[model samples]
Target: MITKGRVTATLDGDFVVFMIGFRLNKIWAIHKWLPVFLAMPKMLKELNSNKDLGYLHHEIWFGRTLILVQYWRSKEKLLAYAKNKDAQHLPAWKAFNQSIGSEGSVGIWHETYQATRGTYENIYVNMPSFGLGKAGKLQFVGKGQNNAQQRFEKNE
Candidate 1:
């Protein structure tokens, strides 16, 4: 399933930190790969269906490890999908645990934060060799507009 959400807060300047995760079941080593192929189309469909949800950022590392970073307008919208029992997410979570929970064939994890009290900045540079470079710089807002402007200028 496509992990979806919005940015709650910016942290450490570059990190547009939010909560996201997905679950996948283990397939027989021989046939396991088949599910991924079958699932891709469905997953992609769901993602496209929620196009207006938020800014979706994700990366699949080493194939199995899925990482998603997104910015959302509020936590309510994020939680609504997560709590949807009939959605693809709920069934997928069950299947993953049943098939891979024991052998560690499948697993899912997520972290959520309430972003408050910080100024955040980020840069995304796409390079041919590197694909994408991401950075987050954050600091406390102090004094007034003058201080914030100075910090922002320094960062630029």
Candidate 2:
């Protein structure tokens, strides 16, 4: 449901923001890009099914350049999940390297960020819980959290 008023979110401690995506360099090369595109859902399902993986939540946008923003409980957990041999990510990564490496038919990239309390602030107006709000604590904007500056100043 849509939240009618301004809302904010806060995580208890440090968090990780992982942005991962692919660009269809050759849109017609379905053979190459399709597999890459298909791999993500499997990984997502794996992560979601196992909370111990430290996967928090994610938001995705699709197009020629797909974008996925993921939240994680910690950087160590994120790296562990990426490198785990038992996970779907490693296999999918290997397949991508073998099938599409340097050919440019599909391009993939990711960036990771470590966030601590007092380092981030967010607000959502007239929207349902989303992004950090979905991954962390969601609440109505309070007296000291009404503005970005104020939110940033919060002691947490």
Name the Cα RMSD for model 2.
0.8
In order, what lDDT does every prediction score? 0.43, 0.94
Q: Per-residue lDDT of 34-98 in model 1, one digit per residue for the tens?
A: 44334434544565587454323434444455555554434665566556785565566566566
Question: What number of backbone clashes does candidate 2 have, counting pairs of residues 3 or more apart or in separate chains?
Answer: 0
RMSD list, candidates in order:
9.2, 0.8
Q: Which stretches of candidate 2 lie over 4 Å from their true place?
A: none
lDDT of 2 by residue, 24-143 (tens): 999989999999999999999999999999999999999999999999999999999999999999999999999989999999999999998778899999998899999998888888
Q: Model 2: what TM-score?
A: 0.98
CA RMSD (A), model 1: 9.2
